[model samples]
Target: MSEAKSPQSTVDVNTMTAIGAPRYGDGSVLRTEVVVRPNPRPDEILVRVRAASVCQGDAHLLTGMPYLLRLGFGLRRPKDPIIGHDLAGEVVAVGCEVTGFRPGDAVFGSVNSGAFAEYACVSAQRLAIAPTGLPLEEAAALPDSGMTALQGLRDVGQLTAGQSVLVNGASGGVGTAAIQLAKALGAEVTAVCSTRHIETMRSLGADHVIDYTTDDFTASDRRYDVLLDLIGNRSLRHCRRVLAPKGSFVSSAGAPGGDWAGPIVWMGKIVLANLFVGQQIGILLMRPRRTDLEFLAGLTAAGKLRPLIEKRYPLAQAGAAVQHVLDGHAQGKTLLVV
Candidate 1:
């Protein structure tokens, strides 16, 4: 860890291109514009973003779906219009208080927001060295989805080696990571996806692949110790049928429910259902940590985990990228090559 300071980097460039939404609506609201590049605070680092990924959360911010998000995000419009969070980039400068990194380090991490630009200021605590063997584009795909999978399975779900774990909606960003992480945790992994993604799930080390297009996984007699639900398409009773008596059900995402509350309503339903059920049902709100980022990096370096990238877009096409994710049929992560 080096504590070195570079010159005030923001002096050279005042503006940079970014994808921003002036007001909330849909991906159509995202516009590529020349915005002021941010300066790193004393505890932050200025990164020249190489790649950033589109997440479902970005869609929520764009559309203001599940209206509850508007509470922290703005009552009428987003407080911060620039979108995106996960990124992999080169450290261009570091604030005086950021001791662990310096200029030119290859880093990957999550930020509060504003990663849809070529340059982003991120807290020192949120980033880690990019894995040596992976490309920056792939590393950019790791933070949010990877961390969500890890916390949902190992932390909230309390999954352990030899336990039977099933990942529903196993072909999207978080779903792909969940399948691999469950295997890395030594659980017997079953992945549920549409017919097209069945082979992809199997290649990711799933012990079984259920085609949701052809059969209802919940209708089967098989039981699992943990059910990681990335899609909330199934009812509580339907999902419960697949879980063991003492199993855990962890949800990281679900359908937007309606125009106002979105997944918050689904999360509330899950919480209320837990009180009377034998299985532990909970929703995963991922808290990103430097150590967890390092852990995922180690897994990637060791070939125990690999981020699956489904598509790439340029900064100009951010709207399409976001729309692709919101459509919810992507096979894996989607990246914006900044």
Candidate 2:
């Protein structure tokens, strides 16, 4: 561990190009503009962003969706205009109180906001050293999706080796990460995706690939010990039918039940249903941790875990990258390279 500020680096920290949403609406609201670069606080570090990923959460923030979200985001517009979370880059400055990292360290992790810019300030607790052998683009895609899958399966679903596990939406970012992580955990993994993505899922070590186009996994006679529902498209009853006794069902996504309620209504339904059943059912709200990021980075360094990147865009085209994700058809993670 080291402390003390290094000499002034190559990156200029005064001002930078950033993408911001003038108003909450659609992807169209995102605009590329020059903004003052962020300065790190006592427990923070300033990163010159090399790459950042577009996430479904970003789209939600962009639209101010479910109305209730507006409570935390903003009443009439976004509170923090610049949006993005996952980022990998070089540290250009370190706060005086920071230790174990200094200027010139390559790090990757999550942030509260402002990753879609040349520079971002993140809490020291949320970051870890980037993996030795991973590309910055791929590392940038891992934090949010990787931690979500890791916590959803291992912590929430309580997955055990040799148990049967099924992952829906197996081609998207979280789905792909879940598939690989499930396999790494020694579970019998089944993935559900479109016909075009069947091979990709299989390549990721899925024991079985169900083409949702031609098969209804819920209608099958097979029962799984755990079902990680990433799409949230099917009903709770339908999902329950496919779970074995004492199985766990984790809900991570779906359309908002109401503009004001968002996923709260659906989560309530799941909770009420769990009262009479032996099975476990709940929504997965990911708690990002540095330990989880380090674990995933080790897996990446060892060649056991890999991020699937679908496309890349420059900082100026960040809005388009977000639109690609909002389209609901991206095969993997989308990136905004600075």
The prediction achieving the highest TM-score against the true structure is: 2
- Over 290-317, each residue of candidate 2 has an lDDT whose tens digit, in order, gives 8999999998898889999989987777
TM-score of each: 0.94, 0.95
Predicted candidate 1 versus true structure: per-residue lDDT over 1-338, tens digit per residue: 11112112234377888877788886777777777889999999999999999887887678876677888998898888888999999999999998988799999999999999889999988999999899987899999999999999999999999999999989998999999899999999999999899899999999999998889999999999999998888888899998999999988876557877677778788889988988899889998889999999999999999999989987778888888888779889999998
For candidate 2, report its TM-score: 0.95
Q: After superposition, how far is residue 93 of candidate 1 from its true place, in Å?
A: 1.5
Q: Alpha-carbon error at 189 in model 1, in Å?
A: 0.5
Off by over 4 Å in 1: 1-12
Tell me model 1's lDDT, rounded to 2 decimals: 0.88
